[model samples]
Target: MKLKILLFAALCFLSATVIAQTKDSLKTELPQISLSPVPVEVFAGNNGVSFQLIVSKYFKPDSRLGFFNVTQFTGKYDTADQAKNELMSLALISFDIWKGFSLNTGAFIDNYGGFSPTAGIQYLFANKDFLIIALPRFDLARNYNFEAFGLAEYRPMFTKNWGFYIRGQAMYNRNIKQDFLERSYVNLRTGVTYQNFQFGLGYNYDVYGGTFNSNQHSFGVFLRAELF
Candidate 1:
């Protein structure tokens, strides 16, 4: 009986996915960019391509802030069709709060670019010698239609200055247009990083107006220079 019930539910889910596979103006209305921390390796081009740098500084043993930057994602195999095509960003941010907790935020602007938020406390843990970390962040951007999601992430190191991670991110917005545009867009992001820079690729599927379904495969990079 349980197996039958599970099968029925699976069938219904598939049907829903099919029904939602159309162009949604609301889903694609807003800019699909924001500041978040990802590793440098995942930002590779369609093939094996990418260029970036990463850096960080410890404000104290438990507090820190930093940034990720990149000029471009250029290669013969790049979709941009230029040797130096790097026009995507996700700035970088780092913070440590009370009791092994911290915050990370950034702005989604250009390749090799990333940013994480700077509000809230974290119950954090590290994997090895500061090479990897885990945390959850709650964010508020003070915009009704741009409410941010609470996220959980895993960052692991591959080299002394290289790393990667997979993050689950979500946000809720009441302003999602239901007629022909969906205002709220949630994403599941996974990518890698080296130094203070990284590249990410993601997928977006939602409904607000008419349903326009699409996937987001992106390459990113950034730089971090603290001046304080």
Candidate 2:
């Protein structure tokens, strides 16, 4: 009887140990998510001072599937009517299709385009010195449009705490049915960076109108930083 009681107690202890180990293993295998920082850029040009705020977030439940969202607001203080202000936002579910490409299906919203069911392919590449993103999407709305947007940044370290920063962003949107260019713009910036803050020169060339006759150019200094 004593031997049987000891054996029973030992079996119970073994079972509890195995269950605790399994729980620990499952906890370690669960995916962890972290929030990204928001970045803000302000460019003071010859025409006016413009402010831009960008927020991007990503959630990866596992390795193969993820969710992404990006919202941007850009406004120029040159006009009282807020004629040049723009806001664009995107929410997407991303599937990892290849090494650096993701198949994204989402919705896009902007001031000019309104709400659109968007389908796009996103490519992202980032390393210590360079970051690049390119997305080409079609807006499925009345007066459907095809839009291509790209952003690239290069940073080379001069010291441990300072670096040279250069960035370029461009966007082209065209109406597919009407066969006209809706909007296009090229922006370039070069500056010095200390940690997450940058200060430098900036240039902008913008084209408006369906006929693409109206054009605006601006050159000035800019300050950009990331907010945690």
lDDT: which candidate is best?
2
Tens-place lDDT per residue, model 2, 129-213, is 8878787767656566777888898989899889999999988988776778888889999999998898999998888766435
After TM-score superposition, what is the CA distance of residue 156 in candidate 1 from its true location, in Å? Answer: 10
Instruction: Return the TM-score for each candidate structure.
Output: 0.32, 0.75
RMSD of 1: 16.1
Over 4 Å off, model 2: 1-37, 67-72, 78-81, 211-213
lDDT of each: 0.38, 0.72
Report lDDT (Cα) of residue 35, candidate 2: 45
What lDDT does model 1 reach? 0.38
User: Global lDDT for candidate 2?
Assistant: 0.72
